[model samples]
Target: MFFTEMWERFSFYGLRPLLTLFMVAAVTQGGWGWDRSEVGAIVGIYASCVYLASLPGGWIADKLLGLRRAVLYGGALISLGHLTIGISGLVEHKLPFFLGLIFIVLGTGLLKPNISAMVGDLYPEGGARQDAGFSIFYMGINIGALIGQFITGFLGEKIGWHWGFSAAGIAMFLGLIQFWLMSPKTLANIGSEPSRHPDPAIQAKQQAQVKLFTGIGLALLALVVILVATGVLTINAPIVGTYLAYALIAIAFAYFAYLFIFGGLSTDEKKRVVVIAVLFIFAAIFWSAFEQTPTALNLFAYDFTDRMVGGFEIPATWFQIINSAFIILLAPVIAGFWTFLGRRNVNLSSPVKFAIGLGFAALSFLIMIFAANVVIGGGGIRVSPMWLITFYFFITLGELFISPVGLSSMTTLSPKRFVGQIMGIWFIASALGNLIGGLVAGNVDPEKLELMPKLFTTTTLFLGGAAVLLVILAVPIARMMKERKGADQPIDPTQEVPDLPKE
Candidate 1:
């Protein structure tokens, strides 16, 4: 399961780095010849759609198809989407490009949430096995990401964009096959038996979540299309960034209100939910900025950096590899560091980890700040590739500290019955952040950049402020997150993936 997932991610992320460049590249360069803002809009919208779709995907797994079918469907859609995109440029059709992007977005939405849910399903409730499994799975995520950079970045830049993209499509196709073959032998095969998602029971639950999420997503997309047609909104009004953020907040609140206020959760679980929601708000913000590496930051690499290295020019696509590479290298070390801390009787709570993570994030931007100075010479200068590498190093460290641990915490904290809904809410926070990240990128005034300092001072300042806020909340949130009688653990000890459908 892990390897299959990794392959799909490799395909997805491997293609990610090339997207902005593909959009803005000169027609002579086999691109659309769009401007930076135009490219940013496309990337942002694509990202927002992918994250936003997870809610319905997870709900479907919980209530209707179970984990296995959800994953199969998601993989098929993603494969189809990528294939479409691969052939999109063949005819030089802009609408084809947009349609291909939409397909990929929908496919991702269906796949991501359910896959992680399956991991949780594999684990027993609050068991050591589940914890270890998730960590290992996360490591696989980085591994796939690392390999993707080499394959996607290298192939996309060297052979043209479609080749890398087609490779991703092929990977998705294989992943679908791999999962199908493995299901009967895997825990997922056993867990998703008729007794687990009972035809009538889960089917009803899934119907509601799916109905709500799909209705909203489709409604928003319709508005976007209509407004764009009528000139009320640009093709990228909020760059998919703004709406994504808001949509997450909407999901979070709606679910929380429904579950706690009306749905009959215990007081302890409700309190935990409140606390988790606050934490999720921060998650949304953190990811929104960090996610820019592929969209806004990719543009930064293309326009700002000089790509020469020792008489050979580095492909701009290579920059995307840095984060994945950092994750691949650092994840094991970080996991070990946590274990070491645990053995030393010095466990850091999730909130403290978040603070520490935010602190680490400051390092990424600070590196970027210095890189800006590296270009300080009066004329055009590119920072050494090492700078971007180090920047990703910092970001990766922070992500390791917060992302998985926080996810584990949410599953641990949530009421068992609504785990799927809570996970969807958590994902919603990411949606918000991603949307904001796009908005920030879209609003970046390239001309005003000359009026300001070379360093991304505004962005840096915002991140710095967020880091400080996280630092302040570390202790309180930690205190609040302490387990209350441990009654909330899931059914199987394999809490690793929290039993959502396969993505």
Candidate 2:
């Protein structure tokens, strides 16, 4: 599962560093020659779609294909999407490019959520070891990301854009093959079948619902096609981005409302739900800042930062390696620090950790303040690469503080019946952030380089203000999160946890 995800991320991240740059590249340079705003809109829409797809992806896995088959299908779709994009480079029309993105979006929606769910399934008896396992899995994700950027970034920039995109396709194909060969024996019993009600009547009802949904989905697809073909519908970057943003927020709010009004949750569960809602907002804010690395920050590396080191010009994409490297180096250290604190009975609640994470996030932009000042003071002279490196380091620190903790809290705080839904909500926050972050990055025009300082300053202030707000509310939120006596904890020393789902 870890390797599968690593390669998947490799392909995903590999494409990201190239997307905006390729969109805005001149015709002679094999790009669409779109403006920065357009590039931002495209990238933002693409990213947001990827995360948002997880909602239906999870639903499909649970109700239809089961995890194993869903993963295989998803991988195939992703590979095909990459190939389609590769083919688009040779064709005069832009249809293949957009079609390719559509396939990738659908495929990722199917794969991403299911794969992580399988990871949790690997350890039915969840314990400290489960947390350790996920850390290892996260490391795999970073490994793929680092290597993917190095390889694809080089190929895309130094050779041809199509070649870089093709590389991702090839990598994903290899991952699919690897998973197919090894998973049969290794995960024979895990996620092999759909989970369903044992009762015949209930099962029949579910089957009916699934069929109804399938018919509705197909009809909607056809409707969209007719609309597009007849000129009744038009699609562009901003329009798409705006709609996706609105839709995601609406879905999140509707889901929360349903859970509160109809979920039959206890008062304690309701309180925790409130915490989750607050955390969701915080998650969105953090990701909006963190996700800029692949868009706005990528542009920074290309246009504003000095890429020359000892007279040897480095690839702009190489700057991406810094964040991944920092994660690999710092993750274990941070994990160990948490463990050390845990052993001493010092519990840093999720809200507190998140607040600190926001601070670190702001600190990354704070470092950039100096870098931006240098460029402004020098009248457009590029700053040293070290400044970007420092910024990545601080942001990576913030990620370490927030991301893992956020995942842990999701599982711990959620009601068992809605655990999957809560996790989906978490991803939605990421989706929303990606969309907004892309817009933020799109505004970064290299020609108007003077705006860079203001951009960095704005990010710093936004992050800092969020951090301050979290700090002010952390105590109350943490209090809400505190486990009430005899609420969720095991009462007897030898009895198994009540909510542990049977295999």
Candidate 3:
């Protein structure tokens, strides 16, 4: 599971540093020369769809293909997707690029959740060993991220973007081969079969709904393709993207409402679900601020930060490594600190941790505000690279606080029957965050340099305001959580199932 996810993340992170840069670069430089707004819309839609697909992916694993087969099929599709992306270099056409992204989004939806599920299956009776396994797995993910960002980012910028993409493809294929060879022995019988409720009537109704929804989805896809072909619409057109973004937020709200009002949950369960919904909103806010690393922050590194050290100028993509490096170094420290605090009987509920996360995230942007000020104060002069490093350090700490805690809360708070659904909601919230974050990134202007400081300041306030709101509601949320759980419950020894391979 660890190695499989490591390589998957290697491919995913490998793409992150290059996507916007490739899109917005000039055609003369082997890019499509898209505008920042267009790039943002495209990236946001792509990212959002990747997470949204997880809902169906979980269903497929439970009702149809099973985890082992889903992982295998998903891995194959991912490899093929990267191959198509690499082919975009040869053809210089957008078709391959777009198709490649679609394949990857679908593949990831199938692979990501199932692999983590497999990790849980590794220890049927969970204990400290389960937590330790996940720690090892999480470490593998960061290691892959560091390598991907360092190697792929360098290759994409210094060599050719396609070469970097192809490297990621190769790495994924290698991981796939490793998994296939070893799984028969190591993961035998685990996640090998589907797990569905044994009720013919329920199964029949589910199948019907799946068919209906799938048909509608296909019809919508056809309509969009037709519109694009006829020049009636373009992918990621600003006005269209704005509507889509609003639609996503509405969908999130409506889904939660449906669950709350009509899902027939117990009173206590509904309260817990409400808590999940609140955390979902906060999670979206946190991700919106954190996920800027590869988009807005990457651009900042390229266009604003001074990278020269003595004589050699550092690669802008190399700056992407800082967050991953910090995660790798600091994750264990944070975990140990949490355990230390736990032993001391210091209660840090998820909401409080989330608030802390938001605060730290705001602090990161505040650091950027300082960096932006330095540039403006120096009359549009670039600032030191140390500014970006410090920014990453703060955000990584913020991530440590919020991301893991939120995942744990999702599992603990959810009724067992709806745990998968709640997990899907968590991913969707991240999708929403990435979409909004991309919109924020789209507002960044290289021409109007003075906006940099203002932009960072605005982000600072937004995230800080969210932190304040979470803090204000922390007591109530904690009370809700404690109502369902025992006051002196045994410590849960299992680590969180990761949302993505990254954290």
Identify the leading candidate in terms of lDDT: 2
Reference-based TM-score of each model: 0.87, 0.92, 0.92
lDDT-better candidate, 1 vs 3: 3
Q: What is the lDDT of residue 412 in candidate 2?
A: 62
**CA lDDT, every model vs. true structure:** 0.67, 0.79, 0.77
Candidate 2 residue lDDT tens string, 238-257: 76887888888999899889
Residue 109, candidate 1: alpha-carbon lDDT: 69
Candidate 2 versus truth, CA RMSD in Å, comes to 4.1
Q: Model 3 Cα displacement at 309 (Å)? A: 3.4
> Candidate 2, clashing residue pairs?
none
Candidate 1 residues 1-503, lDDT tens each? 79768877877777766777777778887777776666665576677667777776666666666667777788888888887887776876565566667777777766777777677777745556767777677766777776777777667777887887788778778888888788777663533631244476666665666678778877887677567656787644444445555666777778777877886877777767776776776676568668777876676676667787779767777787777677766766776776677677776655666666766776687777666654554344555677777878788887877687677876677676666656766777666665665555544334434522333566566667777887787656555545443565323111122111111
In candidate 3, which residue pairs clash? none
